[model samples]
Target: MFKHLKSDLPASVVVFFIALPLCLGIALASGAPLFSGLIAGIVGGIVVGALSGSHIGVSGPAAGLAAIVLVAIGTLGSWENFLLAVVLGGVIQLVFGFLKAGIIGYYFPSSVIKGMLTGIGIIIILKQIPHFFGYDADPEGDFAFFQVDGENTFSEILQTFNNISPGATLIALIGLGILILWSSVLSKKGKFFQLVQGPLVAVVIGIIFYNLTKGSDLWGISTDHLVSVPVPEDASSFLAQFSFPNFGAIGNPQIWVTAFTIALVASLETLLCVEATDKLDPHKRVTPTNRELLAQGTGNIISGLIGGLPITQVIVRSSANIQSGGRTKLSAIIHGFFLLISVILIPRLLNMIPLSVLAAVLFIVGYKLAKPALFKTMYDLGWKQFVPFIVTVLGIIFTDLLVGIALGLLVGIVVILIKSYQNSHFLHIEDKSNGKHKIKMTLAEEVTFFNKGAILKELDSLPRDTYLELDVRKTRYLDNDIIEILDDFAFKAQERNIDIHLISERGMVENPPSFIEFFKLRPKSA
Candidate 1:
């Protein structure tokens, strides 16, 4: 891990800047105390990162869990009760790791995974628009079809536009300008500019702008436009902000439901992030998925015990970690440590940074994830890939993350089944010298129940009095259901005077007793 100290240190700075607002935002979205998000972010970075095998993956409070957390808090009647559920969820994730369930990540298609990443990119851009314009109704810019405030995502955007804050808008514009200049111009000019992250520059500029406009009545920048950084007067006061769990609520069945909800959603998100981070790693390092699951589980457990939101390997944070040039897990660990130290030692300093500045940072992030080039590349991959990719993007845009993925997966499975059906049967016919048609049928590599219809159709199409050869040499698996179909076809072939020859790994059998009985025959004792 220390091999890339120079690279990792600089990367940690960029990741730290990227993580700061997301930590606060996700907590706010979860309907938990803002500090809880910070706690989770710290644990995700330090605890999970230290234990994880992933070189560049980062973890934190995910936006995907925001809705679940909000509902859990309400159903459990308190944020503390929700923490208990989060801890339980962590235990469940550890069980998933022990069971070796992390292999499930390998089954997801590449197209679906790409779709998920692209969908999330689009959602981030959409969700941040209101915050960019100074709308703070929902703290972290949660992008649900229906918000906790009883408004849809689009409705909230409209409402924000109608009630736009001028000072916030101006600050946002300036911050965006600074970020763009830093990325597009200064970043390429010199190594110094590249080393200095764009978000940090935007944030510093935002603070200066805020101070410059703080006392001027002519500027029209109101207090509403300023960053609402929570400030506690002293150490005792700050400690008072921490909330403990309501262990008494453990008896409630609703608590279990919330626990399962967190476990499942957090686990899925973590797995997806692990897969995505591996794809993005410049070194192509493969993360140990089970180990990652255990690490995430432990982090969630610790976070919940401390009144923090549940943690996951969030794609947004992981992507940020990679794009920032993180070369080792140390970057992630250090970033979390920074979160822990910042809230404890420099809360006031953090409060000085404007939301517009953070928005500018996220704007760049969103662009990197959902650039036009990504869309074009997916499109060029053909409809099989593009269809699911587009559906996922649209679904996530109109619905939510999980729903979009489900839709994409559904489309992806359909494509697979269609391809399977098309390739299930191969037929060849030639005229034999003995006044019989010589026929050959080659079954697919794997004949499952799904291939039954095609196999049956092919068998039924054979002409009477034809000599048939069935080849299963290349087939590795034959489902019982498909074997039954072949069994039935054998009797029909006899009736049509179609002499059958079976070729399999077991050996060639001419005039077999029955298809089912033939397949059941094992090698003789030898």
Candidate 2:
């Protein structure tokens, strides 16, 4: 992990910059204390990062869980009680890891995973645009289309037009230009530019811009548009930010329910992110999913014990890390340490950085993930892949992450069923032999109940006085539903004067009494 220190360090810094505001924003969105979000981010980075087997995946307090955390806080009665639920959720995730439930991540289709990455990329761009122009109504991490501010995604963009801040807009544009120049030109010039990173430069310039324009009413970037890390005055005040879970809430059945809810949702989110992150990794390293669950479970347990929100593998930060040239888990761990140190020592300086500048950083990340070239590439892959890919992209833009994935997965499954239906069997016809229609039906290997309709349809459509050849040489597993159809079809063949010849690897039968009986009497032909 430490072998790529030079690359990892710069990538870590970029991830830290990206993660800081998100931690605070997610916490604020979750209706939890601002510091708690930082706690989750710290734990997610340091603890989970150290323990996880993923090289590029980064874990943190996820925006996806904000709504759940918010509702659970209210439903469970108190902040401390919610913390207990988070702890219990971590325990549940540990159990899931031991049970090897992480294998579930492998079941998701590649098209769906690519779709997820692209969808998130598009969301990041759309959501960040308002912030890019200095409209700060929505928190940084709120990726859902409908926001806590009572505005939807598109509506928020319209709102941005009326509330743009001149100074913020200027710095944001300048920051974006710096990023583009560094990424496309300057970074290619030498090793120094690579190590310094475009984002770090943009952030520093943004801070300078913010401070310089502070007194100007016409161009000033206000505190509202800046990073809002909780300002702790002294040692005692800083320590006081940590909130312990209420053990007294253990007896509450609602607490247990909330814990399970957090566990299930967090696990699903982590697994999905793990899948997506691996896809983004240039090295194409496969993360051990079960180990990831265990790491996240441990991180959540630590986070909840000390007044933090639930943690999960977050795609945005992970993508940022990957895009910034992160090569190992060292980068993720270092970013967590930066979050911890910055919040403690340089938070005031950190707060000087404008949200619009961060938005500029994210725009680059978003563009990398959802390049227009990818659309045409997916389209060329055919409708089976493209439909799910596009559906997922649109679903995420219009709804949320999990909902979009569910929709894409549903479409993927439907596409699979359709393909299965079409490929169930191959039917060939010979030029009417002796004035009687002759057809040969070749059943696919592993024909199941899904193929019942297609097989039945072809059999029913056969003309009277037809000569039929039923071939099963390649079939290995035929469903009983299909066997029953064939049995009935054999009876109909007699009424229609359709002579049947059954050909199999075993031998040929003029007419099988029952496909079920015939299969039972003979070995399953290979």
Candidate 3:
């Protein structure tokens, strides 16, 4: 894992810069203590990162769960009570992992997964536009179109027009320009530029800009537009940041219900992200899904114990790691340390970096995710693939991440059912010189319950006294439903005077047994 530290270190720095605002923003959205998000980020990076099987996936607090967290905290009546639920949720996720529920991730079609990534990309662009232009109307990292703060995403952009801070706008534009230059040209110039990324340089420039424009005219930006990490005046106050879960709340039924809810949602979100991250991995490494669930569960447990928000594998952070050249889990571990050190020793220094600079970095990240070329590619794949992908993209953009995926999955399932209905089996008829219709029915490689209707229709349509050949020579898996259909047809074949020829790897059988009995006795077709 440490074999690629040279690449991982710099990538970790980039992910660290990306994660900071998101950690704070998600916490702010969750209605939990600001420090809780940081705690989750720390645990997600250090603890989960160590346990995860995915080399590039980064875990943290997700905006997708903010509404749930907000409601759970309010319903539980105290933040401590919610923390109790979080711990319980971790236990449930652990159970899910052990049960191998991670297989659910594989059920989603590729179209939906691609749609999710593209949708998130579009969201990042739309959501960050205001931030990039110096409008901090919504808290950082709140990408949902409809926010808990009673504001919509596009409206905030309209609002930005009325509240533009010239300092932030100038810094953001400069930051984006620096990022483009570094990534497109400067980074190729030397190893030094490659080692020290554009984001680090952009951050430095932001801090310098913050200080230089301290007393400027209209160009001056306010403290509200800055990245805010909680600062402690003394060491004791710094140590006092951690909070413990109220274990007594475990007795409440509501706590358990909330716990189960978090587990279900967090697990699903984590699984979806794992699939998406694996797709993004340039090396095409497959992450062990069950192990990833276990890792996330363990991280959430650690996070809740220390008063942090529940954790999941976040795609935004994971994609940032991949795009920034992360090669191992070390980058995630290092980023956690960065969060720890920044909050502990240099929080005030962290606060000096403007939100716009972070927005600029995310803008680039978002652009990579939802490149215009991807839209064209998806569209070119035809309606069968394109519809679900587009719907998932739209759903994610209009709703939250989970809802969008669900929508996409729904469409994908419908497409599958349609295809199944149309592709169960193939039939051909030839006129024989002996004055008979030579009918042959060929089964699909795998004929499931969904194919039962189609198979039955072909069997019933055979003319009386026809020479019928039922071929299972190429089938590998025949569902019980299809077997039952064959058995019933076989039982009534004598009444129709239709001679049936059953052929398989076992050769021709003059008298076919019951479909179930025949299948049990003979080897399946290859």
Give model 3's TM-score versus the native structure.
0.91
Backbone steric clashes in candidate 3, count: 0
Identify the candidate with maximal TM-score: 2
Runs of candidate 3 exceeding 4 Å displacement: 432-435, 459-467, 483-500, 504-526
Candidate 1: what lDDT? 0.81
User: Model 2, 338-412: lDDT tens per residue?
Assistant: 999999999999999999999999999898989999999999999999999999999988999989999999999
TM-scores, all models, native as reference: 0.91, 0.98, 0.91
- Backbone clash count, each prediction separately: 0, 0, 0
Top-scoring candidate (lDDT): 2
Better of 1 and 2 by TM-score: 2
- State the lDDT at 199 in candidate 1: 71
Q: Mind giving the per-residue lDDT tens digits that candidate 3 earns over 1-526? A: 7899888999999999999999999999888889999999999999999999999999999998998999999999999899989999999999999999999999999999999999998898888888887888787758788976687877777887898888899999999999999999998999999889899999999999999898887777788889899999999987788888899878899999999999999999999999999999999999999999999999989899899999999999999999989999999999999999999999999999999999999999999999999888988988999999999998998888999999999999989988997888888888873676788888888889988777788888887777888888889988878888888998788788777788898888754757788888866444
Give the runs in model 2 whose Cα sits over 4 Å from its true position.
523-526
- lDDT: worst 10-residue window of model 1: 219-228
What is the lDDT of every predicted structure here?
A: 0.81, 0.93, 0.90
Candidate 2, backbone clash total? 0
